[model samples]
Target: MRQRHKPWADEFLQENTHLIIPDPSNYKNKWHEVFENNNPIHVEIGTGKGQFIAGMAKQFPSINFIGIELAKSVIVSAAEKVQESEHANIRLINENAENLLDMFMTDEISTIYLNFSDPWPKNRHEKRRLTFHSFLKRYENVLKPDGELILKTDNRGLFEYSLVSFSNYGMTLQEVSLDLHALNDPENIMTEYEEKFSAKGQQIYRCKAVFPNQK
Candidate 1:
C-alpha cells in the first residue's frame, strides 16, 4: 500500500551505485571512510522510497547518512536518490533491521533514525518490533557512547511501547512529543511517511533517547 513515486525518483538512482555497500562484513567498522574526512554516520531505518533520506542528505551537509531498508524495490529506489544527488555523504544498504548489530561494530554509529517504522500491532508480535528491548540493546552496541536514537511514528501503541522499552534499557529519554507538528523544530524534517501520516490527521509521536557514555 506504499506509494512508489517521489516526483524525482528516476534522476536520483542514476549515480548512487557506489553508496550501496555490498559486503557489510568487510567494512563493518569503517563505514565513515566512505565519506570525506570520516564524518559521523547517521542511519535511517525503513527508508521507504527515498525522498526522506535524499532530502536529508541535501539539508544536513555535515553528517553522513545511510538509509537501510529491507525491501529490494524500495532500497533500489532509495539508492537511486543518493545516486541522483551524487553526494558522497549519503549511502544505502538493503538489509533488515535485525541484522543491524551484526553489520556494524560497537561505537561505530553516531545516530539512528526510525521514521514511521512498522508498528507490529499484535501483542504477541511486539518483540519483533524495532523498539523492543532486545533491539535497543543491539542498537546500544553499535551506537557511540552518548549516541542518540530518534524515532517517529503515527501509531500510538508503538510509541507507547517504545517509551517503555527505551526507559527499561537505561537510556535517557527526552524531547518526547505526541504531536510532532506542534513543535515546529527544524531538526524534525518531514519524510514521505511523515507527510502521509500528517495528512491523515494521525498524531505523530517523536522522541530522542541517548546511550550512556563509556567510562
Candidate 2:
C-alpha cells in the first residue's frame, strides 16, 4: 500500500521537529547523550506510521527507542503520533537505513527491528531486502556484542530468505514463528502492517537473529 503525498508534510514535521533529530550523523557515538541516560537503545527501521516502536516505548519506559522512516511524508505521520501521545522516550529520524552506520557507532545499538519490510520479490533485487545478508552484516557491525535483530513480515519469501541470510552471516537464530498470531504470544506487539494483515487472516512470520559472543 502506497502512502498518499501530503503538501503539508514538511510543515507537520516542522511543528513536531522536537521528535526528530535534524542531523543524526552528528550524534554518532553520542546517542546515549541524546537520550540523557545509559539505558539500552533500540531502533526500528522502516517504522511505518510508528505503531510498533511507539508501543515498545510505552511498554518499556526504561529503554530509549528510535524510529527511522525514509519518506518525509511517511515520517510526518509517525512524528504526529508520538507528539499526540507525548511519548518522551521516543525519537524519530527521517533517514534511509542504508546510512545506518553513519548515524550510529559500533556497539551503540542494543537491538534493531525490521517490521513488514518490502520483500523485493525479484531475485535481482534481493540485495535491497532488509533481511538480506548485506544488511545483516551491517547490522552486526553496529549492534552490541549480544545485540539482536527482530524481523516480522507477512511475505513468506522474505522470511525464508531472511532465515538463510542470518545463518549464512553466522548469526544465531534465537526464536522464530511461522505463524505469529497463531502463537498467541502476549508479549508480541503488532506493527501497523501486522495488525492489518493479521486482521485479514494473513499469517505473520517472525524471527530473531542474534550476534554470537566473540570467542
Candidate 3:
C-alpha cells in the first residue's frame, strides 16, 4: 500500500489557490482554456518544490501546465511562488499520481513529466516506481492517443528499467537523450532537479514515450 504523506499534508492542499479543478473527478477537460485559445494540457507528477513547473509555465506561456504532487508541505512553497509570480496558465494540486484514473478523463492530458521520480530501487519496491508497467497503464488512461510521457532521472538503473518497460508497453521512444545538460540545444529547459543533479556531476536520462493508439 502507498503510505500516506506526513501529517498536515492537507493544510497546504488548502493553501493551493491557483489549482483549477473544474471537477476533481473529471480532471481531463477545460485545462487548455487558459492559454493559446486552446493549448496542450501537460502534467507533471511529483512536482516537488515546484521549481520545474513554475519555470516551465513561464517559459511556455502558450501551453497549459499542471503540477500534481501529493505532499502538501512541498507543494505549498510552489503554490506561494505561483501566487507571487502571478502565473495564470499554471496550477498546483495535492494528489497522488496513482489515482490518476479517478481524477482525469480519457484523452485529457497531452504530456506528462516524470522528473526525478522516486526510484524505488529495491526488488520488492520496484512496482512502486512511477515508470512501472502498472503505472504506465494508469497513464495511458488519461493521456491522449498521441500524448507523450517525458521522464527525466539521474538513476541509471531506473532509467534503463523504464526504457524496457516502455518498450514492453509498445510505446514509441523519441528525442531520447542520456545527458540533457550536455545538449547545447535551446529546446532543452533545465528543470530545478536537473540543474542540481548536474551540478553534482550526475548524468541525467531523459526520454519521451508516445502512446500512439491508446487514450
Top-scoring candidate (TM-score): 2
Lowest-lDDT window of 10 residues in candidate 3? 14-23
Q: Name model 1 segments beyond 4 Å from true.
A: 2-17
lDDT per residue, candidate 2, 104-198, as tens digits?
99889999999999999999998899988778777888899999899999999889989988888788899999998888988788998888898
Predicted candidate 1: what Cα RMSD to the true structure?
Answer: 3.5
lDDT of 3 by residue, 1-215 (tens): 24446576565565454363434554445455544357778889988877888778888888888888776667766677676767678876677888788777788888999999999889999889999999999889898898889999998999999999999988899878888777775766666677888999999888888865944
Better of 2 and 3 by TM-score: 2
Model 2 misplaced stretches (Cα beyond 4 Å): none
Q: Model 3: how large is the Cα RMSD against the reference? A: 3.3
User: Worst 10-residue stretch by lDDT in candidate 2?
Assistant: 10-19
Name the best candidate (by lDDT): 2
**Residue pairs in steric clash, candidate 2?**
none
lDDT of 1 by residue, 58-82 (tens): 8888888888887666777667566
Global lDDT scores for all candidate models: 0.81, 0.88, 0.79
True-structure RMSD, every candidate: 3.5, 1.3, 3.3
| Each prediction's TM-score versus the true structure | 0.89, 0.96, 0.87
lDDT of 1 at 27: 71
